[model samples]
Target chain A: MTGRLSNKKEKSIIEAARKRFAHYGFSKVTMEEIATDVEMGKASLYYYFTTKERLFQAVIAVEQQEFVREVESILQKNILAAQKLHEYVGKRLRYFQELLNLGTLSVHSFFNIKSVFKKSFNNFEKQELLLLTRILSEGRATKEFNNKLPKETAIVLLHILQGLRLRTLKKIKGQQLDEKSYKNLQKEMTLAIDIFIKGIKR
Target chain B: MTGRLSNKKEKSIIEAARKRFAHYGFSKVTMEEIATDVEMGKASLYYYFTTKERLFQAVIAVEQQEFVREVESILQKNILAAQKLHEYVGKRLRYFQELLNLGTLSVHSFFNIKSVFKKSFNNFEKQELLLLTRILSEGRATKEFNNKLPKETAIVLLHILQGLRLRTLKKIKGQQLDEKSYKNLQKEMTLAIDIFIKGIKR
Candidate 1:
């Protein structure tokens, strides 16, 4: 029972840290602050994760792993390539919205973590690109998509999705985005995707 | 002759300071460091700009004004809205490339400036949004673009452009992008614009 309690405490600490880091960014956040938020001694926090950097990296790793798993599960299900693409885009956007709602999609923190874990981040990005490429390739073979540069198209789609996600978050934070504005964004995204698919169709 | 010489000195100081701030970011740059680069006394540097923050703001302001002017000139030309958008997009992308090459588009510096001049920056953003909305309204009225949410579409386009600029810079630094990759980015931008225009047309 004590071991289980300790494990739960560690999990709570990590959750609090992720929220803090995402809200304040890595450079601005301190271990002691996170420790206080978690209601644990700083030393106890250190015992769980040797350093602030490591702790932040671990948090990001876990998030990325979970994201990849969700995406992979969707992709692995047997479906038409077009339907798979639609699901893929929908899932990614929905996940992004959830993160934004949780205040875990801060651009500053995202870039900070990228710099700190450049190699690992790059590897993760490459894997994402590969998955996208596979989807595009399958779509083309099945005549669900037009033949075009898969990697290039994938990057474009990723950028658009990311852009939409950030804008949605900004709007929610009263940064020139309101409900009406958000709805417009959704419409534009849908149109953009439709146009892209249409342009590339054989 | 004396006024001319002083003007030359001021220009040199601004140029040197711009380079230092761009490379090292505002937090890391020092007045003395900028002075040394321009072979001027630190006191003399102070005569031109009262504080580092002011100097940094001045640097961005000058560039911002020039960028606005260039974009305005492109928009004001008597041409079809489609041609205008094409020029606008191409010119903006090129400007971002030039800024990135000059090391003036660092994410760190952008955030620093954003924090330092939050109100002013917000005002600038609003003005930019207005400009985009005007262009989109014109495009739709002229049947150059499909009728859609101008503001939301503008926000998405702006974000994508910014992301592409950052990604391109990262690639140039031997970090993530390559020549082929950059060409692909350009292609995607072209494709995105084409689809947007097509999707909006009646």
Candidate 2:
């Protein structure tokens, strides 16, 4: 029971810290601000997090873990590779949208964190690339995808999704995208996917 | 003759400032550093460009203008839409790669400047979108491209290119990519173009 309570407290602290860091950036945010937001004493916050930077890193780690879990779940599902790839793109976009809504994913802060956590970030990215590569290989083997370079096509697909996320951040903030815009984006995405499949088709 | 010399001096100062800003970012870079690089006193540097922010903006303006010109040239060339789009993608990628090599483009700093120049950037994006829409419309009219959502497709296409630029920066700085990686990127880009054309073909 004590362990559970402490875990909850830690989670709450991390959530508050993520909001503060996202709103003010890592350099501008202070520990006291996080404490205030979490309705905890500064000393209690320190007892949980130790330092502001550590708290910030913890927030990012939590988000990354959540994203990984989502991707892993999709990968594990017994779906066709083409379907898996499509879902992968959609799921990743949804994950980013959730982060953006929570104000936990800004392009500027993402790059800053990448610099500080270069090794970890690179490893995480490599894992994603590997997953994509595997899916593309499966698609190629099944003759569901056009014949082309799987690795290169995977990278291109990743970039297209990233670009979509970035543009979404620019246009819509916390508000859910309207049905019309969502449909338009979906159609465009489907078109892009179709193009990839056709380009490589035998 | 005096006016011409002053104009030359201004250009030199801006060039020096661009190098400094690109290397050190806007906040960390100092006017003294730029002046030293230009072999001039700080006061003389200031005379040519009023402030560091203005100098940074000027550098951005020059790059943006050059990019616009290159894109415009590609658009104006008498070519099929499929061929034109292919060339445009290749030229844009090559242009950015050159900028990266010359140390004139930093993805991190560009994001910062993007926020500062949001209005002008949007205007430029809108202009590019308009150009793309025209080309796409022509492609459809001539039965070169299938009648897909032209504007939406254009947005996705642009997003993919931009995303590729960002991904390239990450791979390069992280020491995870090489020249061969770029060739692979080009291949994937061609694949993407081919797929789009195929999907839209009537």
Candidate 3:
């Protein structure tokens, strides 16, 4: 996962695999085909990814990294807690759309790998819940949000986000996300966040 | 779909298919096997369902019937709008658990036949939204709830419900719904309803 040459090779492998897997799906794509596409011998590809599943996991993890980075930056912003909540939720929705478009992950894909990646997914959710809870706590402290149930509220907010993500992804199954769909997706996301803001404001 | 003999035959087929599909998933279960279980000729089975996909939809429809009945009953209740919303959401979560336990339908199964059953599912959701919107509208009329966007709020609530359903269903994927997980699911559902109630109250 480190050193310049090794990193470059791994990145190319993942990039190639993402396209292959997206087009053919995880079950259809083969390790030999990935190696040939990457112009690397089969053995070297195995050196980076022990199996087809591991390669899929690596590709998914790459997607998760971008999400984590975006979330961390939003959490560190010096802004009102309410404003941060809005921004965080918007960014979360956008990334989800991107994820579906890229075919890096979706509800179906997640379900397919649920048992394999349960611990990793749960940890990622807990981290996200922690950040949201912090924002709610800050909002409560500043009297911008009702303080009685910040922790519980954050968790529910995550559930709602998951719901939106699942709903949107369902719409996009076996279809492409287009310009018009983008507008509608944004409109729905904004309305949900507005409702949440209404609910949270003191 | 009526008449005692006709209804009994259809019910038997659905019951047998549900058991087969739940134990082996849609991909593994076959029309011939379902017919054998029902002790009917394979050709006669086709009289009920044109294809395996149609049979799957019928099995899912039976599950949908129970859910629709529950929602209709809740909507007809003489209760405050806020209380009605709480009850509707609680019932929604309970039905979702029942749905997973029945294994008659799932996010994955839905995705698999999304194109085939899109119309039916859309109609079902439209009815659900209409009921929720009516409740929100009544709340606004009585000044018991904020009502700037009744229709949109109802839609978002449905999305959140989908989220909780997806979350709960995801946990039960490739596993059973253990007792502790059920308690946690109930707790989470309660918190989500409390937040929604807070958000809508004037």
Candidate 4:
């Protein structure tokens, strides 16, 4: 009972903190404000999260988990591998845009704390690679793909996606990922994936 | 006669500055040092180039011109489109590695002056797009490539290459682009180009 109650308390804290951070940004939001919003003592909030960065990471983790769950569902769907790959690209772009819009940090701030967030980013990449590998393997197994090296292709694809995102972000430096730019990026990514699909298709 | 002599003087100064900057980096190397190396007075160096930054830009322009000349020569060669593309990719990687190794600026310093260098970078990209479009168009005209939108494909390809480079640099932040990483990048880029070639082939 005590464990369950503590979990509930932690969840509420994270929820309160997310809203605060999203509204005011990571540097602007304070732990005391979060505690006040959560109706918890500052000391109790500290017990849950040692630092604001830690809390920010927790929020990001939750968001990442949600994205993974969605991707996993798509993976489980009975569909053509090509369709899955397209869906993955579309979802990946949307998720990334949403993440950029999280308001907890601007694009510049995110880069500023890159070292602090490197661990989470690495974890996310691993998860993404596994998901992509499974998709590629499925396609090959179904004889829908002719690529002899699914794992290598998956790794390359991941790097390509990351590179594309970085380019877009750099182009719009200091500004939020606006709708027009997002659509432009979406179109280019979709086309790039189309070419990749053709390359690997039997 | 005076105009020609001035042009020659400026060229010599730029050459001397390039050598100094490459050896000592931008911060360590001074305009006075470059003037001394070129056997000119500080006033004469100022007449030729206003600032260290301007001299750095001149050096970069010269390097960019050399790379472009090499690429153009490859374009003029009698070869299959596939071979030409593979050659282009190989040359691009090697040239970029050389640029990184110039010792004139570390990756971190390059990023620090990103805004200042934006104009030169933009010019290079425009030149690259034009060259890539030519290749794609040539391939299409010969019926060696099937891509319908040569220009669009060129733009996407440029972004992809940029993205890949950014990802690699991020992976090795704060360190020089070492030989091993260069080899790894070369391998991955070669494979990427192969996939791209397969995608566009007739």
Candidate 5:
């Protein structure tokens, strides 16, 4: 019963922190404020997350974990390889654009970019590569795709997705992103995916 | 004579800074060191470039300028559309991989990421898009490629190339680049280009 209670408290803390982060971002949200919001002592919040960065990691972890499930569902969809790939890229564009928006929304900013975050991000990338490789191999086996090297192709796919992510998430240094820019960004992503789809179409 | 002399001195300063920047990266190499390498007084160095960052910018500008020239040369190459695209991408892979290497080499890091750097990079990106658009259009006109959206296709090609650039230049946090890793990176680029080329082939 005590263990369950602790688990419940932890979830509440994570959720409270997530809310604050969504509003103020990682840097702006303070532990004490989070504790006040959760109606817990500041010390108790420390017991949950040792550092602000750690708490931020936990917050991002929730999103990334959800993303894993999303990728799995994309894989599970009973669809053709070309369509599967196209849909998957579309999902990635949405996910990243949202992440970009979140980053912009937050004050302290996720861009604080701790080493721990970098480590976890690399692990996530490996997972993405493995998942992409599976999709490509399955597609090749069905002869729905004929890219001879699925592993490499998978990496390229991720890279193409990443290129789109970079453009969407980060504004080009000097150019301001207006509503039209965002629309154009979306259009560009769709076009890029079409090319990738064509590239791999059997 | 004054213009010629000043230009010559500016070239020597840029060369010295480039060599130092390549060796110690941006943050590590001091203005004093670059001046010494150029055998000029520190004040003279300042006269040429008021700050270390500006000098570094000049060094990078030299590269971006060379890249423009290289793209022009690629456009002039006598080749079929698919082959030209393939060759152009290869050139990009090498150029960006080297830029990535240079970034990894510098101290304080190019990631110091000044606005000036961002503006220039955006400009370089624009140049790349224009060049890719030309090649794609030329290819389409000859019926060597059949992508219906050459302008959008050009952007995707550049994005794909940029994707390759990011992977080759930067290490994934937890991963080490061994000989095999290097070979795999090369193979991945080749395979990606092959797919893109095949996609466009009429």
Candidate 6:
């Protein structure tokens, strides 16, 4: 019962911190403010999270878990592999946008917390690669795609998509992502995916 | 004649600064060091190029001009559009490697001179887009590729390649690029280009 209660407390702390960080950004949000918002003592909040960066990371971890779960669900659907890949791109892009918003980070600010973000991102990237590999393998097994090297193809595709995401992020610099920028990214991804699918078709 | 001498002096200064910057990186190399290397007084160096950043930009501008010239030469070769693209990728990757070496920049250092670099890169990107469009249009004209939209396809392709380049750059962090990493990037780019060609072919 004590263990469960501690877990609950941790989750609640993360939840409250996420809102604060999202609203005012990582730099602007304070642990004191989060503690006050949670109606907890600052010392108790520290017990749950050693630092603000740690709490932000926990929030990102939760987001990453949710994203992976969604991707898994998409894979489980009985759609064609090409359709699955397309769906993955759309969903992945949305998740990226949300992740950016969650941190409210500028390019300069991103560097400040890059080490923390990178730690979380590396694990998420492994999950993504596994998911993509599975999609390609299933596509090949179904004979919906004829690419001899599914894993290799997946690696290339992921890199291309990442490249696209980085380009869009850089173009926006520190500005809040607007509808036009988001739509342009979607359009580019769609075209890239279309070419990828056609290239892999038998 | 005075104009010609001034231009020659400026070229020599940029040449000297490029070597220093490449060997010692931007942050470490001082204006005095570059001036000493070029046998010009600090005041004289300032008269030609006011800041180290401007001198570095001039060095990059020259590199960019040379890279464009090489690409144009590749385009002039009488070969299949697919072959031209493959050659372009090979040459482009090498140029990217050189650019990385030219600055000796870590990711952190990159941010310091990012505005200056971005100004040069933006112009280079435009030229790259136009060249890619021309390749696609010519391929379509010859019935080697059936894509209806050359410019759009070019945009997507450039974005993907940029994504790949950024990914590789990030992987090395601040470490000098190794042979293995360079080879891995080459392999990935080769696979990506093959798939791209297959996708766009008539």
Question: Over the stretch B1-202, how does candidate 1's per-residue lDDT look in tens digits?
Answer: 2352358777687778778765665566889999999898899889988887667666666566667778788779888776766777787666555444434444434554356556555766676666677788888887777757777767656665655555555455523234676676677678667655655555
The predicted structure with the larger lDDT, 2 or 5, is 5
Clashing pairs for model 2 are A146-A200, A146-A201, A147-A200, A195-B195, B146-B200
Question: Cα deviation of A192 in candidate 4 (Å)?
Answer: 0.6
Cα error, residue B81 of model 5, in Å, equals 1.6
For model 3, state the Cα shift of residue B132 in Å: 0.7
- Cα lDDT of model 6 by residue, B70-189, tens digit: 999989999999898898889889988877776645523655457756766788999999988889899999999988999999999888888888788767866667899999899999
RMSD values for the candidates in order, in angstroms, are 7.6, 7.1, 5.9, 3.3, 4.7, 3.5
Q: Reference contacts recovered by each candidate, as fractions?
A: 0.26, 0.55, 0.76, 0.79, 0.57, 0.84
Put down candidate 2 lDDT per residue, B19-129, tens digits, no spaces: 776565566678898899889999988887777766766666666667778877877888988877888778777766544543444333555445665665677678777
Q: How many backbone clashes does candidate 6 have?
A: 1
Q: How would you encode candidate 5's per-residue C-alpha lDDT over B21-80 as one tens digit per residue? A: 666556667889988998889998899888877776677778877878987987898888
Per-model TM-score, in order, reads 0.62, 0.64, 0.72, 0.89, 0.77, 0.87
lDDT string, candidate 2, A17-43, tens digits:
777765565666778888898898899
Off by over 4 Å in 1: A1-83, A97-123, A142-144, A163-195, A198-202, B1-48, B101-116, B167-188
Tens digits of per-residue lDDT for model 4, B1-202 = 2353358777888788778766666567778888888888899889877877777777777888888999999899999878887888888887776666554335346555557667777889899899999999999999999999999998888888888888777777645688888887887787778888888988
Every prediction: chain A TM-score: 0.68, 0.68, 0.78, 0.87, 0.83, 0.89
Better of 4 and 5 by TM-score: 4
Model 5 segments more than 4 A misplaced: A1-6, A36-45, A50-52, A98-119, A167-184, B1-62, B97-120, B167-185
Worst 10 residues of 1 chain A by lDDT: A99-108
| CA lDDT of each prediction against the hidden true structure | 0.66, 0.68, 0.76, 0.81, 0.72, 0.83
Give per-residue lDDT, candidate 3, residue B19.
86
The order of the candidates by lDDT, greatest first, is 6, 4, 3, 5, 2, 1
Q: Which portions of model 2 miss their true places by more than 4 Å?
A: A1-49, A52-66, A76-79, A101-103, A106-116, A167-191, A194-202, B1-79, B97-120, B169-191
Steric collisions counted per model = 4, 5, 1, 0, 4, 1
Per-residue lDDT tens digits of candidate 5, residues A17-125?
8788666555566889999999999998899888876776676677777788898998999988777777777776666644543343342245436577777778888
